[model samples]
Target: MFKILIIEDDLKMREIILENIHRWGFDGLYVKDFNQVFNEFINYEPHLILLDINLPSYDGFYWCGKIREVSKVPIIFISSRNSNMDIVMAINMGGDDFVQKPFSLEVLMAKINALLRRTYDYMSTEANVIEHRNLILNLKDSTVSYNDKKVELTKNEFKILYVLMKDKGSIISRDSIMRSLWEDENFVDDNTLTVNINRLRKKLEDLDIENYIQTKKGQGYIII
Candidate 1:
């Protein structure tokens, strides 16, 4: 099933949209951390995003630009403001489409389905790769390549790199990585994550990529 992320702040609207999304046979994800919108997007890896222009911390445009920097995930701007400039700005900010607020569920679903069809149908088989600064991580082969040099990654290393690159501009905590590695962080070894990270870094260094991953000193790691 395709995952659809709802970044709407209005509680009632979010719930309604989520309910309809599930009813339409799509996996729906809602954000719990408003400040970590990109992190949630990376973790969920949604096929499409439904973003609201008016948000609590940062507006949808800012988050849209952040997501565009990492992935080409489809984004639809949903907002009450429907001026010509708002619509234009949404499209210019890498949004695929715009849906005005107080919209009918049927209309929204139609737009989403059409967008998804157009997006996935024309995509190539190799399009599953996630890229960051010329470093390509192939989702199909589980390999990372940079400048004609490639390295294979362990399952844990791939997961760590995927999460880090997904939230490139933000710090991802060790606790979060632990939770991603295991269902419960408490069961994970304290040094296991550190060891995996070091191995991943070494592999990258082999490709002449140095300090790509930055340590935030007690915070966690970030790709910058």
Candidate 2:
């Protein structure tokens, strides 16, 4: 089932949209921490988003632009602000649709279904980048970016970072990481892996992102 993320701050409206989302057979996810809206969007990797214009900390437009930088996932703006400018800005900010407040649940569901169909029928839903903290690793270009500075990665560096970031908090053994590289046809032993790890760390350090990949002593590595 397609997952829909609800970014509304109003509890009552959020609950209503979430309930109707599930009722229509789509998986519904929601944000409780308004400050972590962008983080939640990365973590959930939802197929589509229902975002409210007014929110605490930052408004929907800010978050929408941030998300647009990483993925083209469909976003629908739901807000009480029905101004022509608000609607136009929503579209300009990468929102796929705009639904004013007090919208019909049936109409909203229809729009959601149509957008999902049109978006995914001929396209892949997998995100091309993985984000942790403020770091974004672009799988398409084998590049790691922090702040606005980007560093190109070698095939080995990209593979290693991809393995660790894909399972951010988990302790991946050296054997496991080496096996992942092996699967990609880049065979390497323990010493070679260590060199690659140090090189990757140095690149991250250049970006001022220190200690991003932590060594777990007896264990292999982890990104937390």
Candidate 3:
């Protein structure tokens, strides 16, 4: 089953969208905090995103751009704004489709299924695999299974791992980590990154991951 991520701030709309996801026969995620869009997006690893434009601090376009920076998962803009410019802007910012607000729940679910089918249905039955030592990261399925046992990772942990794995054996600076993981937040300090990294390290350790994600004395971390 395909997973959906809803980024809308409206409580009723979000619940409706989530409740109707089962109606579309799809399993997915609904975000808890507008401020933590990136966090939820990375952690859930949903195949598609349902985003709203008028958000709490930053708008949908901004969050869409942020998501595009790391992942190519599909994004659909769902908002009250029906202006041509808004629609055009949404597409330009990397949204796959636009669903104007006050939409029918049935139609919304249909659009979601259509998009998922088009993007993933016939593409490949295989999951994307990236490895370092014994650890395996499946990009397509957004899963990091260890030694054939699925090791669960939060969005932050996965994103951090993705960035690190992409630059394996290289020193990825703390600033860089902050930039990638903290893009969606209004303000993220070093403490937040530290906490996230620490938690990720614990998870990796539990998986018996083999790597040297070394903290280079105020420089950064390197998965060597």
Residues 1-224 of candidate 2: C-alpha lDDT, one tens digit per residue: 68999999899889988998886557999999999998999999999999999999999999999999999999999999999999999999999999998899877876887787778851145488989999999978999999989999998899899889988999988977875555322356999899999999999999999999999999889998
Where model 2 places Cα greater than 4 Å from the true spot, the runs are: 122-224
lDDT of each: 0.87, 0.88, 0.79
For residues 34-134, write the lDDT of model 3, one tens digit per residue: 88999998888899999999999889999999999999999989999999999999999999999887888757766765677678843266347778776
TM-scores, each model vs. reference? 0.55, 0.55, 0.55
> Clash pairs of candidate 2?
none
The regions of model 1 sitting more than 4 angstroms off are 122-224
For every candidate, C-alpha RMSD to the true structure in Å: 14.4, 15.2, 15.3
127, model 1: CA deviation in Å?
16
lDDT of 2: 0.88
